[model samples]
Target: MTTADALYTVNVTINGQPHEVKVPARRTLVDLLRYDLDMTGTKETCSVGVCGACTVLIDGEIAASCITLAVQADGANITTIEGVANGEALHPLQQSFIDHGGFQCGICTSGQIVAAKSLLDSNPSPTEDEVKEWMMGNLCRCTGYYQIMESILKASK
Candidate 1:
C-alpha cells in the first residue's frame, strides 16, 4: 500500500492483553474498542466527549475515548468497563451500583462504572461531595444523581 493508503499498527494492552491492531489515523479509541475489537462495555453516548459515556482507563487514568485517537493509545494500557469485573463476579463498584440503584435504563452504566472506578482508585475513601464532583463528567438522565452518589460512596466504604 502507498503511504496515503497505509494503515497504522498500534500496539496496546487492553484489559491486560497485548494487541497489535491496524487502525486508520482518524479512528477514535472508542471505535477501536467497540467496533474493531468488539469491546461493547465502553458505551458511546456523546461522540463529542462531553457525556463521558466513552470513558476508559488509560494506564489507570480516566480519559475520554471518543476524543482520543486510537494512534494515541499505542503502547498504553487501557481498561474498559468489561475489564472491571472478575469473570462472573462483579466488581465492588458494579455490585454497589446494583445494590444502591445507581442506574435506571442502564445506558449510562458503562460510563458511570469507568468514571467511578477512576474516583475509587484515586480516593478510596471519598466523601459524598467528592463523589459528586468527580463523577460530574458522566451524565445520567435517570436517578437524578442521588443513587449514583450513594453507590460510589458505598463502594468506597
Candidate 2:
C-alpha cells in the first residue's frame, strides 16, 4: 500500500463542533472541509497556497486549507467560512461585502471574508493601508479590490 492508502483519524473542533474523522494522510484540509464536512463555503482555487482561495482559521490564525493536510491539523480548532457568522445574523464583514459590493462571480468571497475576519479579530480597527496589506493575499478576478478593501475597513469599525 502507498502512503495515500494509510488512513488516520483526525480529531478536531470545527466551528465549535467536535469531530472524529478518518481520512487518507494525503487529504488536504480543504477536502476535509468541503467534501467530508460539507463546508463548501471555503472555496478551492489556484490549488496552490499563494492565492489564499482556501484560507481558513486554524487555531485562530490564517492558513491555506488547500495546502494544509488534514492530519496536520489534528487536535486543532478550525474555523471555516461557515463558522464566522451567527445562525442567521450575518457577520459584519459578510454584510459589508454585500453592502460594499466586495465580490463578483462569488468565488473568492468566502476566503476573503474569512481572512478579513481573522484580521478584524486581531485588530478590530485597522487602517486602510493595513486592510490592503492584510488582504493582499486574497485575489478577486472580478472586483478591482477597492470594494473589498473598503468592506474590510468598514467592517473593522
Candidate 3:
C-alpha cells in the first residue's frame, strides 16, 4: 500500500460517547471530528497551534485539534464545543457569553470558550490578570477581548 493508503484506528471517547474510527495516518484531530464524526464546533483557522481556534479538551487538557494527529488521540477522552453543554441546558460559559456579549462575528468564540472552560476547571476563581494570561493565545479578529474576559469572570462567580 502507498503511504497515502496507510490508515490507523483510533478509539476515542468524545463528549462522553465512545467511538472507533478508521482514519488516515495524516488525518488531524480537527478533521477527524469535523469530517469523520461530523463534530464541527471546533474551527480550523491558523491550522498552526498558535491561533488556538481549534482548541479542544484532550484528556481534560486544552489541545489544538488542528495540529494534533488523530492517531495521537487514540484511547483519549476528548471534549469539543458540542460537548460542553448539558442535554438541553447551556453550559455556564455558553450562557455567560450570550449574556455578556463575549463574541462578535463568532469565529473565535468556540475556542475562546473552550480555553476559558479549561481555565475555570483548573482555577474556579481566577484573577483578571490570570484570565488574560491564560487566554492570550486565543485571538479574536473582532477585538472582543473585554467582553470575553467579562464572560469568563462572570461565569466564575
Candidate 4:
C-alpha cells in the first residue's frame, strides 16, 4: 500500500481508558473518535479547525481534533465531551448550561461545553471579558451569547 493508505497502530488513553487501534495515517483524531471509537459527541462541523465543533483535550490542552491526525495522538491522552461527566451525573458546566439556557440547536453545545471546561480548568475565576474572549473561538448560531456567558460564569461560582 502507498503511504497515503498506510495504516498505523495508535494507542491513546481517552477519558482515562486505554485504547488501541490501527488507523490510516491520514485519519483525523475526530474521525477516529466519532467513527472508529463510536464517540459521536465531538462533532465534525466545518471539517477544518475553524469551527470548534470537534474540540477535544489533548494532554489537557484544548485542541481541534478535526485538524489533528490520529497518528499524532498515539500515546496521548484525549478527553472528549463524553469524558466531561460522571456516570448519571452531569458536570457543573453541563448543569449550568441547561439551567442558563446555554444552547439552542445544540450543534455547538458539546464544543462550547468542552471549551468552557478547558477555560475553567485554566482560569477558574476569569472575568466576564475573559470568558467572552475565550469563548469567541466557539460559534453558536442559534442561541445568543448572553446565555453561554451566564452558564460559564455561573458554573465558576
- Which candidate gets the maximum lDDT versus the true structure? 3
Candidate 1 lDDT over residue span 41-110, tens digit each: 8888879989888889999999999999999999999999988999999999999999999999887889
Q: By summed lDDT, which 10 consecutive residues of candidate 3 come out lowest?
A: 1-10
- Cα-based lDDT at residue 40, candidate 1: 86
Comparing 1 with 2 on lDDT, the higher-scoring candidate is: 2
What does the lDDT come to for candidate 4?
A: 0.92
Write down the lDDT of every candidate, Cα atoms only. Answer: 0.89, 0.91, 0.94, 0.92
Model 1 stretches astray by more than 4 angstroms: none
Report the lDDT tens digits of candidate 3 across residue range 1-157.
5687888889999999999999999999999999999988899999989988999999999999999999999999999999989989999999999999999899899999999999999999999999999999999998999999999999996
Runs in model 2 lying further than 4 Å from the true structure: 1-4
What are the RMSD figures for all models against the true structure?
A: 1.3, 1.5, 1.2, 1.2
**Lowest lDDT 10-residue stretch of candidate 4:** 1-10
User: Candidate 2 lDDT (Cα, whole model)?
Assistant: 0.91
- Taking all chains together, the TM-score of candidate 3 against the true structure is 0.96
Decoy 1 TM-score against native: 0.95
Q: Which ten residues in a row have the lowest lDDT in candidate 2?
A: 1-10
